[model samples]
Target: MEKSTHEPTADEKYEVSSSLEKGTNADNGDTRFIKSPEERKLVKKINWVFMPLVIMILFVQFIDKSTLTVSALFGIYEDTGITHDEFGWLGSLFYIGYLAIQLPNQYLLQRVPISKYLGVILMIWGVTLGCHALGRNFAELAGLRFLLGFWEGCTYPAIFLLISTLYRRSEQVIWFGTMFATNAAAICIGSIIAYGIGHMDGHLNIRAWKWAMIIFGIVTFFLGFPFYLFLADKPKSRWFRLTPEEEKIVDERTRDNAVVQNREIKRDHILEALKEPRLYCFFFCSLFLNLQNGAISTFASQIINRMGFSSLTSVILNIPYGASIVLFVAIATVLSHRFQEIGIIAIISCILPLLGAILLLVLPLGPVQLLGLYLSTTSPAYTLLQTYISSNVGGYTKKIFYTSANIVAFCLGNFVGPIMMVGHTAPRYTPAMIGFIVADFLTALMFLYVRWSQNKENNRRKHLEEKGLISPPPPNRELLDLTDKEDLSYRYRL
Candidate 1:
């Protein structure tokens, strides 16, 4: 049989109608839709499927990555013949491998099935984490750490992409916050696990720290199969069963997100993204914010140890640090959702850390200094930054590029963070604290600039609409897959 040459009809080419949908208001002609009871139920179902999987995957990744710090307390350094300075290199090298592969990973994400890609990487890294148990020196452990970082590099971007593809822009902040908050929770869980494992000293002739790596690694390895089976790449994936109406709702939601679902890379989209000033702004903000994270996450236990606490006591002290992180993340996300103003909420988040930095710099090593350290868990602000990028950026390729650039900056900050705390600095790493304070202040300023730029664009569009210079956008404009700069009708949320 000869192949038929069939062209798509206009209706088929654009599945959405030009008229506003049922939930949206036609009078104001806004694209925003209030969810109906049916839509709410559908969202709930999606949450049930996605939330636990993401939380578990991310939690394990955090726990596995954090094992280095816990192990440091449990005598991985002494047992493995590694010095404190060499240990910093281990932390920094992970990000080096993480940074190196991101551009290629972005391309792979564009071409591959996301769930399968993530699944394979998860399993590889799981084995890599377990290998840490066998390393007896710096070179051996550092090599495994690099491989672990390289494999784990794609995990966060994949999760961010999944959340963006699944949820509306307005709903993304809460979900992002929820997933990232796992990092804080992981600190406590890791500490408790380490404390338990510490009691296993001399069992089976293996060290407690080594056993920590082995146990978490095995658990992570087994998780990969189930994750691959359960995660849906998009709403249309075989993992989900949707009625016709529900499928239509998913399509409508995609349109409302103002991002392309198409996988094809567009050169114009990349060029446009390169020209965007906001892209660079977000990049620097990510870099500076994570510098603090690099320092704190790797050295929190050691700092407590320096304050005259025993190894076990130091591990327990991190519980308060973890609690503070959960509190800050919860508050920031809720306030951002309530006010619909991430910029301001991000500023508040930064301010707390800035105060924490000041306290750390001035106060002596005691309960007060510890209080400052706990207050410095501004990592939640990083979650807000991720939400900002996913919700504001448009076009598939541009979004990918934006996220890749942000990750590069994130890796750079993490790579440099540990290096700032020299061994001689010890408990009073005054210079590092100073760097934290400065970075936090600059991040706040960057958020302000983003908010200002968005307001300027919104006002210009409003004026043009009033003067009849530009017509309101068609309801199907989002289906066109235009970049944010190309889509004049798209107003950025603060």
Candidate 2:
């Protein structure tokens, strides 16, 4: 894509220059602060206070969402009299609800306390999940699924906002990896739970699938209260007991990363974000990658069952699938941290899934097909994409808008994914696997485009700086809540 050739308007130039002058004055002292032992201690303290709650909530969320897929093997469809196509609609409609609330959810994230907001929604969704136990027909189940999606929509945006607010850009990838790795852990744990629950078909005079929904929902519902009480909204929140000097250090660290903790929605940031090429690149990449996710997440167990494994054995096999996700996510995160190249890591992750798709398409239905399915669990790419959004986007509103837009695209892809695999394509699902290959390749292409665009913009900034055509950015630019396009010195991380 062609780079934008328009220069900054005079008003924009003056605003940046003034902000730079003020920041220069404020940070006039030597700004080269090394990471001291105290900073490490602060980080450790922050991790202890923050990471656990977020990880737990995210794990529960994934498990709750995965219930439909797991329960399918144990007779959700058979008991409810839902046809195969109707089952696919259940997956798609959930995303419809998810997509419907994204814009409002983004606005809420900006104006409300994220932890409190998420907690409320989590409780609501938990109730919705539990209500799935009473779903006697397709309509009832679909309604519950839609409501579940609506409430759970708050989760990713809130978590992304929290990570961006709390961690530095360099630290975000690992944290994202850690948070998403819980999905894998959830799968492992959830499978074991499902295997055990599958045997309780007649207990309580309820179907085993109903038991799974009720039990998981109850657990999810109770956990929300703790998140409400304990999760810190930001560094300046009174919940964290930091000395004045420690607060100052925290402020400086955030400024160094060029991210401001701004709450008011900025129309300019939204407009600017709408015009950025990278935004669309990221959005489309997320869309395509998650298409594969929609199919695999909803049907992996069923696929295993079709391979001659009993339903119980299929549920148990998800442990290995979950392990692969954890392993790849960890390795990809470590690579991104060491190299500081999220784009490259993301591309590599995409390729793994594409290869998996090929195996699913071409290999005979057996161990190799299963191997391909497991390999295709490229959820690490989604984690990296979240890291990219949190790290590269500047201005709170723009960040919110960008992430929300990406989620909308994510919902669309998921909505379309399962529809592509109807009853006719059951065993091999050749066409669906082919679609996965196409989506994976396109996603990788988009990632490369995003990398190129960021590098291009970075080079343009460097060239302009060398020419002395623009004033150097102030150290406190982050405080201004300027969009990356508005901040001349802002460089995109690849």
Tens digit of per-residue lDDT, candidate 2, span 1-494: 99999998644543433232222111111123345565667777788888899898889989998899888887898889999889888888889888988989988888888778877777888888999999999999999998888888788878888888788777888999998799899999999999999999889799899999999999989888988887888887666677655576577567755667667888888889888888888888888988888888888888888888888999999999999999999999999887777888899899989998888878887766788888987588888998889878888888889889889988998888878778888887888888889888888888888888777777787779779987977866667888777887766778
Task: Write down the lDDT that model 1 would get.
Answer: 0.83
User: Against the unseen true structure, what C-alpha lDDT does each candidate score?
Assistant: 0.83, 0.83
Runs off by more than 4 Å, candidate 2: 1-34
Clashes of each: 0, 0
**Predicted candidate 1 versus true structure: per-residue lDDT over 1-494, tens digit per residue:** 99889986645533433234454222222356567565677788888877788898899998988888878888788898998888888888889989878988988888888878888888988999998999999999999989988988988888888888889888999999998788889988878888899888779999988999899999999889978778878866665677666677777778767775677889998898888888888999899988888888888888888777898889989888887898889999999887677788888788888898898888977766787888877677888998889888888888888888989999999988888887888777889889989999999999989878887887787678779987666777757888777877766878
Worst 10 residues of 1 by lDDT: 21-30
Give TM per candidate: 0.93, 0.92
Q: What C-alpha lDDT, on a 0 to 100 scale, does residue 141 get in candidate 1?
A: 92
lDDT measured at residue 392 in model 1 versus the true structure, 0 to 100: 86
